[model samples]
Target: MIFELQNDYIELFKLIKVLDLVDSGGDAKKLVVEGLVKRNGEIELKKRAKIVSGDVIEIAEVRIEVKG
Candidate 1:
């Protein structure tokens, strides 16, 4: 299902923290450390990796598409 996004493009892992997708930044960090975040169908663990337009981020059953 579509997870409505409030940010068009964000740092790969900051998306998790800023969106409140996780409990806190620490939790978001943990999610990345545990390899739970995916970018464009591949597991991405970089917290500062730039995630630009057309990127797909998935966590559990949530899918967020970055659009300009």
Candidate 2:
């Protein structure tokens, strides 16, 4: 899926929550802390990692592409 960024960037956890990938922000944070989320191709442990355009985030079987 593709997420169109309205600002310069969006927090990783917020992105997940905004996309409805999880039930809430806390769930999204848990996913990140547990190493279930990836930025580009590496495991992203930062719940508030800045997600900007051209970045790809993966969680479970879902792939979200950020676009400016």
Candidate 3:
């Protein structure tokens, strides 16, 4: 999947919610809190980690590529 970036960066949880990966923003944060998300192939624990264009996020079987 691909996510077009509209700004310099996007928060991790916000991206999850924007993509409808979870039912709610809280759910999206929980997904990250539990170490269920990966950024650039490594476990990402920060829900507000800055996600910039060209970044790759992975959750479960979903892979989202950030494109400018």
Candidate 4:
């Protein structure tokens, strides 16, 4: 899936929440804390990591490509 950026960036957890990947922000944060989320193929633990255009985020089987 592709997520179009409307600003300079979006927070990792917020992105997951906005995309409806999880039930709530807390769940998204939990996923990140558990190392279940990846940013550019590396496990991302920062829930508030800035996700900019061209960043690729993966969670389980869902892959989201950020586009400018």
Candidate 3 on 7-31: residue-level lDDT in tens? 9999999999999988999999999
Which one wins by lDDT: 1 or 3? 3
User: Candidate 2 lDDT, tens digit per residue, 1-68?
Assistant: 99999999999999999999889999999999999999999999999999999999999899999999
lDDT of 4 at 4: 99
Instruction: Tell me the lDDT of candidate 3.
Output: 0.98
Query: In candidate 4, which residue ranges exceed 4 Å CA deviation?
Result: none
Clash totals for all candidate models = 0, 0, 0, 0
Q: Is candidate 2 or candidate 3 better by lDDT?
A: 3
Instruction: Give model 4's TM-score versus the native structure.
Output: 0.98
Ranking by TM-score: 2, 4, 3, 1
**What TM-score fits each model?**
0.80, 0.98, 0.98, 0.98
lDDT of 3 at 28: 98
Model with the higher lDDT, candidate 1 or 4: 4
lDDT of 4 by residue, 1-68 (tens): 99999999999999999999989999999999999999999999999999999999999999999999
- Compared with the true structure, the alpha-carbon lDDT of candidate 4 equals 0.98
